[model samples]
Target chain A: MNIIVCIKQVPDTTKVKIDPETNTLVREGVESIINPFDIYALEEAIRLKEKIGGNVTVLTMGPPQAAEVLREAIAMGADDVYLLSDKAFAGADTLATSYTLSKGIEKVGQFDLIICGKQTMDGDTAQVGPEIAQKLGIPVVTYVSKIEDIENGQIKLKRMVEDGYEVIETETPLLMTVIKEINEPRVPSLRGIMKAKKIEIPIWDASDIGAEGEKIGLSGSPTQVVRIFAPEVSKEGEILEGEPTEIAEKLILKLKKGKVI
Target chain B: MSIKIDLSKCTGCKLCVKACIYSAIDVVEKKAYINNNCTLCGACVSACKYEAISISKKKKTAFDEGDYEGVWVFAEQKQGKLAGVASELLGEGRRLADELGVKLSAILLGEKINGLGKELIFYGADKVYIVDSPILKDRLDETHADVLVQLIREHKPEIFLAGATSFGRSLIPRVAATLETGLTADCTGLAIDKENKFLLQTRPAFGGNIMATIICPNKRPQMATVRPKVMKRAQRDDTRSGEIIEETILNPISSRVKLLGFIEELSDKVNLEEAEIIVAGGRGLGKADNFKLIHEMASILGAAVGASRAAVDAEWISYAHQVGQTGKTVCPKLYIACGISGAVQHLAGMQTSDYIVAINKDPDAPIFDVANYGIVGDLFEIIPVITTKLKEINGG
Candidate 1:
């Protein structure tokens, strides 16, 4: 089973702050890390590889700094890492991003399965994995929470839906987007870290992947961000004053008034 | 472009009546007549087998900015019932439609859901599109996208809105991609620019730290998915009436993925999305065992239990119950925080709740800033007292 895990480096959104004066994201001091969900995807891929004998290759599309996540994936258990980084790839939307990633996959060679996190923290668009499948003419399953079995060239899995999980069976050469419920990701061992340090990650540009220039970046993206500003926080609660009992009593009356009880 | 009726081929089967989403078509004396409300969606044209109705072909570019009309809300339904967010989108969609001087319509796809179409009309929709098929009984991304994309291409609505539920989040993006249109996700605010008639889609970015107002200036139909409970639902009025048009799937494409069965997560037995009240815990609870107090208080109030990222990261609670940026965004009627300091990530998920009560030992916790009522005391001391008083109030 040759599995390709797609990962991304995202800003620690929790630490991200908005500059009140300028109304812009204060990203200068914030640290970047592997998108938390993608770690689960990588771990699932590694575990699958461990169970059945095969290699796990990690792929990502971003600026040069995104290679850090590739190294991190390798340290965890990925056998090889490829980075699709270029100025032309900047400012891509989900459509363009997925197209570029698909081109990179075509260049990287064959694979039985492709895996990705449910979404990226910054973009939060879960469309890429399915879109890539559509563009590749392959089948896809989203919000997969568990892999039940993989045999006879077909895989059975559990997919999360609105109310419950759906057990699905599909052929190989398929794509799936997994959620954090799937599995707990493993930490990097010292030996794994050393091996990752010695492996040189290859950077692929639009030309390297034979991608069309118009379909690789800002030009290819159909949507544009017109404006960004700080969301106004209108929380001015009536702070109840008094002893604990008094506060509790006041809260009950308020809840009744709000029809919440 | 406009729909043309062929009087010679007219059978007056009335199938077109059920196919017109806008109630824009009526049959009078064994003939079909197109009304003024029609946006030329061509559902009736497709439903007529004898080619009695046809839309005129117009040569134009893909981004013909002037051709699109009306506002549409994707009415999300689960288990044969419409989700609450559908009404909220209608509330917002009505405003946008009125501003644009266009009609507000809802597109519903499900099996045995014609009843929901009338309900949508009662909740501010001027027209409801119904596509009933066994293939559409369940929410599948590819099938739903195919049906929606077909309808969108035939009848171009200037703005499309859907709730950011699991179904909406999974489906809308695929449709948008297939149509080569732009889509903004998890929008908190949606408005129309009176000047250019463009949809102003505002959503929180960077973990709700800032708001980004996005616009698809060149795209024909601007698309967006809104977070549930953020928008107010339209007031229900059964006296109101509208049109329900049944549509047909020209070519039903079977999905390659086969669903065997479903497994309900034990931790999520009580869905947090529909819970009226939520009692959430934080790291200040000290240990996983301390969550018993939080659960006890919740049980007494008949509320669901939630946890902050800290508690979930500490392995005190399952991720299913975590409410934060990375967790589920909930908008219950009441949210009570115990020992929660209210990190912005945590607040982003539940700040929209109608009422909030915070309890913490620290007087300066940020949770108090957003709490409607605050108790600056140890939760261990305060929670049990509140529970006891609540039981007394309820005579339990």
Candidate 2:
């Protein structure tokens, strides 16, 4: 079995701090790590490869520093890693980004299954996986919370919905985006990290992946950023300071005045 | 690099540096240089006072932008009832329509949903197009996208909007991809650009750390999805009338994925969306046992219990009660956040509540920023007092 998993390197948003005075994101000390959701995708791939006797490949489309995440995946037991990086691929929206990734996936050779995180932390637009499937003309599903079985080239899983979840079955040459509930990602073993350091991962650009220049970057992206602004935080709210009972009385009176009680 | 900096015009005022979320720009020797960390988000372009930065746009597209007309709302339905976000999108679409002097249309698909067309019309749609069929009853992305895509192609809407629910998020992307148009997700603000008359879609990224306004500069049928509770619902006018067209599915696409069954987790009693008052807990509650205080307070006030992702991930509460970017966006009459240090994600979900009360020992918690009333004390101390006061009122 050939399994390819797509991942992204994102600044750990959980650690992102905002400047108290300016209300802007403070970038100091923020570290880049694999998107939390994609860790589940890579982990599930490695587990499947272990069970079914196959190989797992990890791919990321980012700057050269993004290769660090590929190394992390390799340490987690992926067989191969590829970095799709080029200036031509910069400034792409979900549509252009997915198109570039799809082209890169095609160059990685045929695969029975492809896995991707539901979304990235930085973007959080869960549109890329399905868009890639659409661009590639393959069956796709999103928000896969579990993998029930893989047999006879068919995969059964649970897809999360608003009210609950739905059990689904689909045939391979399939792509699915996974949620965090799928699996617990494992810590890399020392030996695996040693192995990853020895490997020189291949770098693919727009040309190597056969992506049309007109469809890969800023020019290819349809959405344009008209403006970017920090959402204004309103005036500092009144903080009631007193004993618990007095504060409770104050709050109740205010609620009554506001017609909330 | 798509962005080019003209050193001759460089002032090194550092305004663009302050505007960039990525910290990709730095002034060196009176000129600014962009690093690889930049994704060309174009935030710097607007921040520069000197016009030192320029970006290139795509020269051509598959279709002429003038071919599309009217503003559209995807009227999503569940169990034969229209989703609340549909009404909200229609309300927003109505504004855009009036601004551009164009028609506002609603595209609805479901079995036995023809009657709901009147409601769509009342909510400000000039035209309601229905594709009522059994094949679309199951809410398969491919089936629904196939039907909606055909209508969009035929009608040629200039702006397409939908409620950013699980169904909308899953289904609309496929339709956008099929039509080869641009689609923005989870938009919190929508407006028509005054000069360009383009739909300006504003959304939060980096978990609500920054806001970006995007436009489909070259794409026809500019599409976007606004999160539920983020926009106001249209005022229904029963006396208003509009045209309802029964759209024909020229061809139905068969879905490769088979849905076996749906398992419902939320009970009807404590529906967060419908709850008038909500008392929420977070990691600061310390343990699952302390969470009982939140439940007690909520029960006393006849409010629903809510949780942050941390509380849910720690197994103190079920995910159904989770409120954040990854969870449900809720707007209640009164929201009391207890022991919750507000993260941006958590704030994204419940900031729109009519009245907010926050209780925590740490006064610096971001939750205090949005609260109408704030109490700086241990939740254990403050909640019991509040609960007792509520009980006294209930007894009287």
Candidate 3:
């Protein structure tokens, strides 16, 4: 079996500071890390490879610095890594992004399974994975919390629903978007780290991925950021402080004054 | 101006028509349709179980020079001080105002907020629209939105923006619906299309995997609600000056709702949003009794305790500590996972945490890959060591 894991690079939110006056996020000086959700996809792919005896490939589309995350994935037992990078890919919305990623997957050829994280941090729209599946004309089982069985050219999964869960059995070569519950990812060993340093990551451009000009980046994206701002905080809160009984009495009085009781 | 409703997808579910607090949708022939009075709040989209509703504009308006006009930010105030998000919107308004050569304005509503209006000017608002009344002191969603709709109807703005917080989220949809306008929510990016001065709105979709750009092309006063912490705020310049336009609201104080006594939040209460480090427990903890291990580990790291839905549902922890799609959304610095299998619902809440540490006996736990550090051992045994090490490190 062959498996592909799609990942992304996102800003470390802890370092993310909101500029109070401007109502915007401060992006400069913030370190970028692979999206936490993607890590699960990478782990699941590797686990499938170990069980099925096949190659596991990790893919990402980001700036040059994003290559570091790919190397980390390689160290954790992925057989190959691909970085889809190009200036034209900048500011691409989810619709355009899914198109580009789908093209990148096509360029990589056939795979038994395509695994992806449910979402990313910087852009918390869990649409790209399913969109890619939609564009590729494949079935997608989202929010998969458990893998019940994998055999007979089909896999059984426990899909997480709003209430309880549902068990699904899908044919091979299907796309599965995983949640954090699938499986614990393995740590990269010292030996794997050594191999990762020597590994060469392939960088693909729009042409390399066969993405059309109208389907890859900002030009292809329908959504644009017309403005950015911080949320208004209403701070008119008064601290009802006193002894428990005293505070309760004062609160009741205020409530009566406001006619809220 | 009219809203384009895709009639083909109407399932007659009426979720949207019913969800519309403004009574905008009508179900005719077992199909929901938006009439002339419809507000494009997209509540129908969220409420629609059949995925029947979407917003469309009639036609693009041709713009000549000086076409773009009026700037408004839905200012949310707390205790007389303006919310940081409100100020952030003003900074954005200032830039768009400068580019379009329009006056940047803010609609302020609250009790004793005259002083807040001055700060708005320092931040970049050219004018502050004030609606001050004793009845308007606390945030009553219905009344506040009514005030906003009335003001926008009277003093029309070409563009409007609001923060996507709880208050802003509740208010914007109602105002947009009342005005029969289009509204986009939780936008991460916003821009002005130089061509028609169209407010370009970009937001994540499909649960945060992709960013989608949206536009209210036909709606006047192109409106959007942006998420807090996604944009930068402007610097305060005390030298800058602006005007204050105060309006007297004659509406009776006795309405559907009234402000009650203020209850201060408990200081020791864990705000998962502000917590730097968190130790989360999951179903892998075996039983509710094992949550003590999670709490002990959290104490060692000087972190807060978080629970997965399984843990929360199992009654091992309260819902407040649960992190997932339906629970609180958190982005802590260090998230320690103890016997926690990373479920997507759970991941949705805390996947943005900076450094994740997973301690589970199962080497294949999905939590490990996202974890900065992985300890392939029983958390029960591992946590005690960590606790001891921490105590020694602290000389306690």
Candidate 4:
């Protein structure tokens, strides 16, 4: 199984709402989707390329309309799609977008498993899938919901944590990330959107992925946003409107005389 | 170190596209550009007002920022128990090592970690560091980022904190990419900069509707992680003391991953990040069998059920019963939100909990603006009147 999958094209921060009249962030119609848990890492890399045969590819680094989420991960089946776009790969972070997607996945060559998307709905920082598996020294396995057995090159997964789930195993140029309880992603077959609109999507850039204009963006971002605001939320609390067992017994007797029952 | 805009002092007049909260600025035919989701978080260079965005950071790395000093944290532990954001990052690393005057330390790493370095020097460590191997007994994130990147390249530590938990966000981004330095995730603010002392690090993006601060000047050890209930736990002092040291290195290479054990989710009995009462549920708990009335009011107040990435994306539970910022930033101390609708990504995880009690029948439900106690109604008619007054005060 080849796999690969590393999508991202966020801004649909759950439809980036909250602007109840200036309490900020409406980002209008907030569109540009595709990072809802990397569509279950591109549907578990097209169900591990339709149960172990090979070839799923899909990758992405943004800019050119993020090659429309690598043609929506090749209309859900993914055969190949790269993107990487440029203008010096803009202001990356997640260590220069996992060192420019591990130098565009070592210039796209071999791969046994690399899927990502345990984070990113506009960078909710799941630190770029273990920083692109520590820039490809491989073996990541984060929050992965499951994969369970693979074979002859070892895989076995599971992961999720915080008091539950861990089974891991790993081998074979690995990386993993997943979550959204890994699966149920399908949806896209009209001859797979006409083979993702008759293929032809090779974008690349940043010197065709050799990337390294001081390591890729905003002078290789070592975390630098200097300031940005809008936090203060206390929109004046106390909304106890009555009845419903008298506001649940006056909010549990004001949380048991404020001892927070 | 590069923001640049100046199209003849851009008249794009979009106020840096409403000070871009990672809409990454744009104006197109009018002017201001910088897109591809700009993380050069200078919030559009402070919403440029004709100084037309600049930024240019004076580069020049190659480490030396006076060869780092102390501050560290990482304490973290598990079966040996410790993490509660490791005493809230050693109480914010003893106030940034007393504002960079230096020496705070903590480190730890698990397995038979007895006295956990006197429970991290009774909260506000002056030094602890221990390693206590079992070859880090399969906590692997490249063996705890190669023993915290070889004790942060042999005692450097300008500012490295941890505990955005999930084993410090999978072991501090592999120790900030194996010490190529600069990491800043989940931090709910960290301070220290008064003119180049650096380590600022605020954090929050989109999910919390944007907050940013960040810094790493030239990265010596300025890492970050923070967010476990948003700092503040350092009081315990078994008569204050210091230094422990320890370190026994060498298990850094045999990895191709392994583990194979752990199960736990036996209906997770509280511990939603050390829950002190969480009850969450959202998408107005109108389904998923009404999460058993949020697990019968979290089993009558021994709370901890949480949810709401629209009820874990409508699966109505599990995503470890989510709770904001893409699930889990929790800071409970009585966070009862039922029918959750606050969404600034669920108030960036329980709006620093400490008693936020909403109930939401939508009286403009923005989780009652960080509820300190709200009620509005119909959580199936007030959670059976607050679980029958918490089971009649637990059967008296």
Best by TM-score: 2
What is the per-residue lDDT of model 3 for residues B193-225, given as tens digits with 9 covering 90 to 100? 798677777764433332345776544667777
Candidate 1: what's its TM-score on chain B? 0.81
Tell me how far the alpha carbon of residue A251 in candidate 1 is from the true structure, in angstroms, after superposition. Answer: 1.8
lDDT of 1 by residue, B1-396 (tens): 346899889988776775443356789999999865454434466557688887553333357777899999999997699898999999999989999999999999988888898999999999998999999877777788889999998889989998888778777877877777778888888888888888889887666766667777776788999988878889999999998888897988876677677677676345677677899999899999999998888888889899998998899987778887667788888899998999988987887787888988888888887787888887887788888888998895
Inter-residue clash pairs, candidate 2 = none
Interface DockQ per candidate: 0.28, 0.62, 0.02, 0.25
lDDT of 3 at A135: 68
Higher-lDDT candidate of 2 and 4 = 2
What local distance difference test score does each model get?
0.81, 0.85, 0.67, 0.79
lDDT of 3 by residue, A13-127 (tens): 4345444543334444656677878888888888877777888888888766678899889888889899998867765656567778888889889888899886676566555
| Model 4 agreement with the true structure over B100-188: per-residue lDDT tens digits | 78889888886778578987898889889888877776687887788888888988888888888777888799879877777888888
True contacts kept of each: 0.54, 0.69, 0.03, 0.70
Residues A120-192 of candidate 4 have per-residue lDDT tens digits of 8666888888988888887787888888888988888987787678898878878888877777787888988
| Minimal lDDT window, size 10, model 3 chain A | A226-235
**Better candidate by TM-score, 2 or 4:** 2
Error of 3 at A1 (Å): 1.3
Off by over 4 Å in 2: A17-25, A243-246, A256-261, B13-23, B58-62, B266-277, B300-303, B325-333, B352-354, B391-396
Measured on C-alpha atoms, candidate 4 has an lDDT of 0.79
Q: Estimate each model's TM-score.
A: 0.87, 0.94, 0.48, 0.34
